[model samples]
Target: MSKSFERFQRRKLISSYFSVTLSIALVLFLLGILGLLVLNTKKLADHFKEQIAISVFFKDTAKQVEIDELQKSLVMSEYTKSAVFVSKEEAAEQHSEEIGENFLEFLGYNPLKNSIDVNLNAAFVSTTQVDSIAAEIGKRSFVEEVSYDRPTISLLTENVRRIGLGILIASAVFTLIAVLLINSSIRLSIYSKRFIIKTMQMVGATKSFIRRPFIWTNIKLGVFGALLAIVALFGLLYYLDLNFPQLGVLQDLKMLAILFSGVFILGLLISLVSTYFATQRFLNLRTDDLYY
Candidate 1:
């Protein structure tokens, strides 16, 4: 009977350890997916910002030298990423190609004006800054008009802002819920060993002494879970890259490294915190409460 009872206790201990490790692994997996989503969303937003172009139309009488000077000025500006000059002839040729030979014959002359297309740095892509930039460029003597898709820029800015804010709020809410769920899981795992805790307490074991082994066990399991999550995330990214090379920018080594490091730290912190609190609660529990 004594040997059978000892065997049963060992089995229970093994089962409880597996359960805790599995729970932590599941939580880490969920967090990893959420992290990837947030990172990719940010990259997409930046891509959209890069596509916003500002068109600077040159005056009909504007000389090549004046246009060159204006291009130099724009290139030197803090807000500009790049300035590309499109000569009137090039613009006319492009329009003719699009409309075919018939349209050019009817028009008689190239009415397309010379223009400089300016790409702004992502930081200055906001609606307010875009308006300010247009106004600044309009003051130039060679600039007939400054044209940009104002409605499109405004829509992009608002959408990006709202998406970023939504992601932040969702991340916060998910993190809070994850922590609570992980804590509950850890508590239940510890509860399975309540009798052991009670016996240790009765024997006058110090709280630190009772907690050290559990904390160490949790740390190891947490690291293992995080590594598993990292592997899963890398696999997903690799698959995406293979299937859609257009999104290859997201495969940047630096960004992936940052995300992996963050997940590792998060996994360790969550496990350690949950273990500490769960163990503390068990340690302070009344003898009667142990029955539950």
Candidate 2:
């Protein structure tokens, strides 16, 4: 290549390198956020589930031993995550405090029954699973009644399901859009050097030899872009940690690792594939078509 030709090529390469990296980083950052939401959706759902506790009120005649056994049994059950026993006196005191009056004293005696507050596993938080679990638990001889707000559980499940579906659709659409934009941008960059590709081919350069440099350059750009995305994601997570401590705790390291890996792989794959096709297009084009 002449000194002028070499200079032009070098400038084009530098420009394309930075431009592509920024473009990729912007899209990947958005993708990282979406992936985080997708992962945390389950955590948020589980939090809502935890709020709908199963209150297992004991029968008036239930012996202390039988009540304790039932609490232990529920704690060991597949559905239960935790179970806290509330004595009749404690329940009465709690009710009195809520109303800012000694209702037990005014009523002449405590009326609240001993109960176990059970929290179910996230997997069993749905309406169907909860209903089944409640039915099974209610059958016990000591259980006077098993109660929870069915309407609240149903609302939470329905809202979460709908939101998850919407998010999934939006993520797929945005991912496709990002891929297309990256592809077009890469193609435009390569299009500037169609003549150079033709020159190499005419001078007996093998296709792989011609593609190697471009591929290597884009690979580096892809990695750098992915790193940028990770940094942005890290900042957002840090902010969440500072502001919303509870939600921040849902940021599992394993899930974050998977998301970062996904970003890197996505960036590398898109760059490599786009480079191959863009390079191949010029390799196959007729000399005169370089103008078009």
- Maximum-TM-score candidate: 2
lDDT of 1 at 96: 73
Q: Residue 286 of model 1: what lDDT?
A: 94
lDDT (tens digit, per residue) of candidate 1 on 1-292: 9999999988987787677667766777787778777887877887788788999998899998999998999999988889999988888788778877645578787777899999998889988999999999999887888999999988998998898899889888888887887677777877777889879999999999998887888888778777887887788888888899888835588878878898889878888999899999999999999887
The true-versus-predicted C-alpha distance at residue 231 of model 1, in Å, is: 0.8
Off by over 4 Å in 2: 1-12, 249-251
In terms of lDDT, model 1 sits at 0.84
| Model 1 misplaced regions, further than 4 Å | 1-15, 96-102, 249-251
lDDT of each structure? 0.84, 0.88
